[model samples]
Target: MAKEETVLQGMIDRLIEIGRCYGMEMNVEKTKLMKISRQPTPATIKIDQKQLENVKCFKYFGSLLTDDGRCSCEIKSRMAMAKAAFSKKKNLFTSKLDLNLRKKLVKCYISSIALYGAEIRTLRAVDQKHSESFEMWCWRRMEKISWTDYVRNEEVLFRVSEQRNILHEIRKWKANWIGRVLRRNCLLKEVIEGKIEGRV
Candidate 1:
């Protein structure tokens, strides 16, 4: 931490100096430094001689990044957004449409909403449970199978007739997204290269 703080401060100082040389101004009010570690920073970071606030978490690219790096916050936020999306099209889900049509709607709309920001996520078992709960909730609603019906979960899957469950969909979408990222030879691919290679 000591070394990283010193190096980070030096980088920030250089950035400010370069920006000044180019006659560019940084928005000091919006500037803040986030340290992603359990240990407190030994030194304060400054931008243009102003102290930057340290926060436990920060929102970036529509995802919640925390010091501990747990993804629960982001997952909950995604669930809310996806539920809202489903609610927006409630009429379509509850309509007398074909089973296949409603299934398509769930994939196209709610799945898109829920799976946003999830492509790069390393989902833990708890996270997977939450995701699966939401997916089964949708399936149950689509089949009009109340808890009172006392039907087995297998029955629900049988009723839906969709081969790909939510987890499968997640895996497929994430694979597709990663393929695109890899094809572009992007920075993310560079970061993931060693992990994927080592695992193989």
Candidate 2:
């Protein structure tokens, strides 16, 4: 009488014998075996996982969705870039004592631009305006400051100036009115600082 062969046991015995002959070792811990169901067509799978999980997902790179349920990685990346630029500028603009102070400064930046020399103001604006983006305005202001008589760092001056120019061109290409406001405000800030005069 012959012994009946166990399906999984027989497969493991065959694999081990083959591996021994080839002087190789198989990592059973890293291996998985599956049995297919009796179906003629392949099964479909739907993943309901959230892409922007902060704990397990990558930082500065995650899925962002709109209020309308549009999952756009490109839009998220652009927003992230804008926020990063604002963050870098905010670091240079304020003291580094408290983490919460940066948020306050950003809120101030938004409010300052929104007021725009207004009187009797109540609540401050926290959202972006059609006239300018906070990121662009920050770079423009930095450049304006760098060119002042008190600041003698030519490298910083040139870098901020160059960046402002590049951002200006990008805004122009996008036909954004913010570009015009950026230029006007930049010139105005420079004038106020007594760095340059006469028609910007």
The C-alpha local distance difference test score for the whole of candidate 1 amounts to: 0.79
Candidate 2 overall lDDT versus native: 0.42
Q: Over all chains combined, what TM-score does candidate 2 have?
A: 0.20
- Per-residue C-alpha lDDT of model 1 across residues 1-200, encoded as one tens digit per residue: 33488898888788888998999877778876677665645358888678877777788878888766678778888888988887777888978999888998988888888888787887899999999888887888777778888987778888888543778877887999989877667655655776344221
Stretches of candidate 1 off by over 4 Å are: 1-3, 38-43, 145-151, 177-200
The clash count for each model shown is 0, 0
Q: Show model 2 residue runs off by greater than 4 Å.
A: 1-63, 67-86, 89-131, 144-200
lDDT of 1 at 56: 76
lDDT against the true structure, each candidate: 0.79, 0.42
- Report the error of model 1 at residue 30, Å: 1.1
Q: Which candidate wins on TM-score?
A: 1
Per-model TM-score, in order, reads 0.78, 0.20
